[model samples]
Target: MTYTFDIIGVTPIPKFVQFQHQFAKKPDRSKTYLGSYECSLDGLISATKMIPHKPNWDWDQVLEEIINFWVQSEESIQHWKKQLYTVREESLLVARVANSEALRQEFETLWQE
Candidate 1:
């Protein structure tokens, strides 16, 4: 999977079309937000079925990809200061919602650190 990074506060505008309008007002800079969004090249994917995401998808690999991308591309490390991990319980929530006992345990173990 390809990953892209956006440095908050460095650019007045964000690259993603979805974020461009939302960040227009410049919400609280101190708060950290992490999320995933879906867009289709062809219209069929979204029309056909809901995208199934694993409980730890964002917590594990996705977060690392985002951080790595930013680290490699950004000139200054300061932009990463506000990037925060989405709480560990969120992973447990996703696991419970997906009804995956193993995923729940994985999150529990990771959360202990």
Candidate 2:
């Protein structure tokens, strides 16, 4: 079974569709806000079934794809700072949620640090 989750803020580098094939298959990958300088895409979707997420998903992968997207994109890094991207870091939490309740507690404990 597929679960739905939000890919908080996904915007285009240009005024129109960027179609970052990296996340193309993701369902409802639609543009949201458009300003004088940038465009955005936002959605909650059935991740695996809708989009082709890279496998062997490690915590580093999260930092790479989602976090590093704007950081490495010289042109966009500034935008990330301006927006004040605030997301709950839940990398280990996800795995813990499935492993065991105790593990989940441990995940949160580690995260709080």
Candidate 3:
């Protein structure tokens, strides 16, 4: 599928970069939601700097790099999912342990009283 990228913002810092993938064929042109990447002020500035010397630069290479940096790979998504799951499991275990410890302390206090 073909896609287009748009930089959304008016101020010195752009809000984000939006990309839309073309899903429908021509004559019934339609775009589907791809994703957006929040742009940092420094990144925007650096990107602009690359544009000035464009005549001598490889535009295709530049586009490829930008897309690669913005797009999330399947492996990256899976890795992030695993990391989140591990964090959540650890947090739940810690909470359960803390709750049991608190209950034990309460029982001891009551028995002593």
In candidate 1, residue 67 scores what lDDT? Answer: 49
In model 2, pairs of residues that clash are 10-41
**Alpha carbon lDDT at 64, candidate 3:** 49
- Candidates in order have lDDT scores of 0.30, 0.30, 0.31
RMSD versus native structure for model 3? 23.8
* Clashing pairs counted in every model: 0, 1, 0
lDDT of 1 by residue, 1-113 (tens): 22233433221113332343453244322112233221111221121122222222333343444446544754433323322223322211000011234435657888899
Candidate 1 contains a number of clashing pairs equal to 0
Give stretches of model 1 more than 4 Å off: 10-58, 78-113
lDDT of 1 at 6: 41
- Candidates by TM-score, descending order: 1, 3, 2
Question: TM-score of model 1 relative to the true fold?
Answer: 0.24
Evaluate model 2: give its TM-score: 0.20
Candidate 3 residue-wise lDDT, 1-113, digit = tens: 22233332221111112111122122222211112122332343245342221222334544544455446444543443354345422211000001233345657888998
**What value does the lDDT take at residue 37 in candidate 3?**
22
In candidate 1, position 7 carries an lDDT of: 36
In model 3, the runs with Cα more than 4 Å from the true position are: 1-50, 73-113
Query: Tens digits of per-residue lDDT for model 2 on 1-113?
Result: 11112123433334123433533344332222111222222111112223243332332333334333433455554444345334232111010001133335657888899
> How far off is residue 15 in model 2, in Å?
27
- Higher-scoring candidate on lDDT, 1 or 3: 3
- Indicate the residue-level lDDT of 102 in model 1: 43
